[model samples]
Target: MKKSLRFTKISVLLVAAISMSLTACGSTGPKGGAAPVQAGDESKLFGLSKTETPDELYEKAKKEGKVVVYSPSARANDAKKTFEAKYPGITVEVFKLKSNDLMDKLIKEQDAGLFNADVIITKEVSGAVGEEMVKPGRVYKYLPEDIAPNVDEPFRTKDGYANYLEMRTLYYNTEAYKSAPVSSWWDLTTPEWTGKVYLVDPLSSPAFMDLFTGMVVNSDDMKKAYKDKFGKEIELHGTENAGYEFIKRLRENKPVVLKGSGDVLDAIGKAGTKSQAVGVAVSGDERKIEDDGLKVAPIYDIKPKTSVPDAGYVYMAQKAPHEYAGKLFIRWMMGEKDGKGAGVEPFNELGSWVPRSDVKSKNAIPYEKLNMWTYEAKGFYTNSAKVRDFWIKLK
Candidate 1:
């Protein structure tokens, strides 16, 4: 009986050893199907051997350090705080300037190899600025799904190198045109509206540059029509002599050309009392003017002096000081959290304009239908030196 019991115990030990071996084999994955090594676990998230989200990218960038941004718009600090809160470890710095000054600064920094600019936030024309500052492949590609809903395909590049996220439209004095009878673009150049027009300096302001460029392109046909009607040229610049002809016309006409957008708005708000300047002003700024109880409106017609297409863009620098941080900031700025539909305050809406769309504005020209209007910042800024030379003389 003792011998039989010992044999039974040996049999049980053999079976237990075989079971343990099977369990160990099951835990080992096949070579290619093996899960990745996560920060804490061996199981890969999203079932991929390797793939990272913008959030994950943000975390990686935070560990790497800071981001420096250059923009021509206001409220940079607010944007920085929102980013810092989302990414607890990284730091963001902003350098804000007027659009033209921003371009000059970028060129100077690049030539000196200072390497500070990480990201850029400026008007759509600023894309041309990005084209100048960074090499072709160096700019990052990122387009968040949230911003996608508001943005159309034409304004966005396929690999996301360039995009138009926001815009500024043209505004008019509401008190002067009580019911806004000026429905079409031609109305601006009418005899009734003569000497009532005001324009900001197109040379210095990128927003104004967009406005004027649109006018020049859209007005070619209009210029011809007017020339035939008047039996001579309408003399937009002037029917005067030589070099300062255009300059003289702009100045002697008394445009009230001011230094910045605020000046234009300030002048428009008090147009009734302040020499009656029914000028061209920023649509966004006009909203602010009206919020203060001043009467103002925007005219989106396709006339010689029609409102221009304004688009805002964001970019990353190639020689960014905080490389990873720059990537993190781009993801933050262009992500769902800061985009249009997620209950987040959009820069577009705050500026009181539509994001890029096919929808037409009642008193404004929709980008789709304006065959004459075009926003070619690359053409203008690439030749900005030449344009500025002419502009200085004109001013």
Candidate 2:
């Protein structure tokens, strides 16, 4: 009986050994798939070498065949159509997701040794790029030499990525005001405008947080605006600076805070509405003035500043499966390849301002004419937590 039991145990051990060997053979690469293309070498084939021309890069990308991009914009679909049309052999697969969700998925997948996305097109420079991707080496900096010169300083980061600017402007009901009644940023905090202003809830939207942080960064301008409007320097009421003072006053004024810009637009822009609320909205939302018959117009010529520039940045994944294709797509999106301004159509449709000096803005009001405040991406990343906490406490 002992000999029989020992034989059975030996047979079971052999079976287990065979199963382990088969599993080892099956697990060929990270995440148990075919080996991913080795990256990190400075080679034209891998899209790291900047020496390759657009045409050469296109050829290499075509050989790679596909690029998978994750973006927050639905415009990615339009871009996909244009890119695929331009390079018939290559396929561009875009996954549209919220900025935070995209980052979370990327991080989770990266931790699991899964590198599915080749590129990320997002406006989350401070939160996602600065805090997450760059810190962990999940993304590689790859700026093509051909397109590098055209990118503006404000839109290009030190870490080697490019961004396109979108304007967040103050909007008022045209019928209610006839023209924009508010000239300065401080005008909204007054008795007449109190409880009449609308804004997207800052706590929920990083863009709104960035805008508030932008106001803080440009406290000098806010100080001047305060002095100009109120005829005296702003007195901080348990706040740090003029920006915070303005925020505190604005909050105390009982302004309507909504979930989204769309809701704000609907409330403030709806025709025949009795409320004369003015809200902060994107320039793209101006299209609704005609489309929705909304009696809203941007306070474009307001004193000190009319809008904050929201910039969108793109990055390549560190372990990009199709690195060459990713690089090609980036270049194509920046309008470096064809020179006929092929890549910017999707952005144009959405009324976003391109940061490339050579690309002219398609907005009714030219970018040069607007009083614009720029967000400091690095500063926003570093101080966002503090700002968020302060804002929450104030609220």
Give lDDT: candidate 2, residue 19: 32
**Model 2, which residues run further than 4 Å from truth?**
1-51, 125-128, 156-163, 301-303, 337-339
Q: Per-residue alpha-carbon lDDT of model 1 for 1-395, expressed as tens digits? A: 11111223244446434322111000111121112224533222211112235577676686667788887765456667777877778888778876546656765666586656767666544234434322222333334433444544444432232223323344566666565555544444455656765677776565565544443433455565455544676554542222223334444454566777767666776646533455666655645664666656655543333444465556555455565566556545543433432112334343343334632232244445443344554444443343345556665
Model 1, CA-based lDDT? 0.48
Alpha-carbon local distance difference test for all models: 0.48, 0.67
Q: Give residue 387's lDDT in candidate 1 (0 to 100).
A: 37
Show where candidate 1 strays beyond 4 Å.
Answer: 1-52, 124-131, 134-141, 144-150, 158-170, 181-186, 203-206, 217-254, 271-277, 335-346, 350-372, 382-395
lDDT of 2 by residue, 273-388 (tens): 84578898777666666788888877777657765666666777756788778877877777764334577667754446676667766677655566777555556665566677
Candidate 1 local Cα displacement, residue 232, angstroms: 11
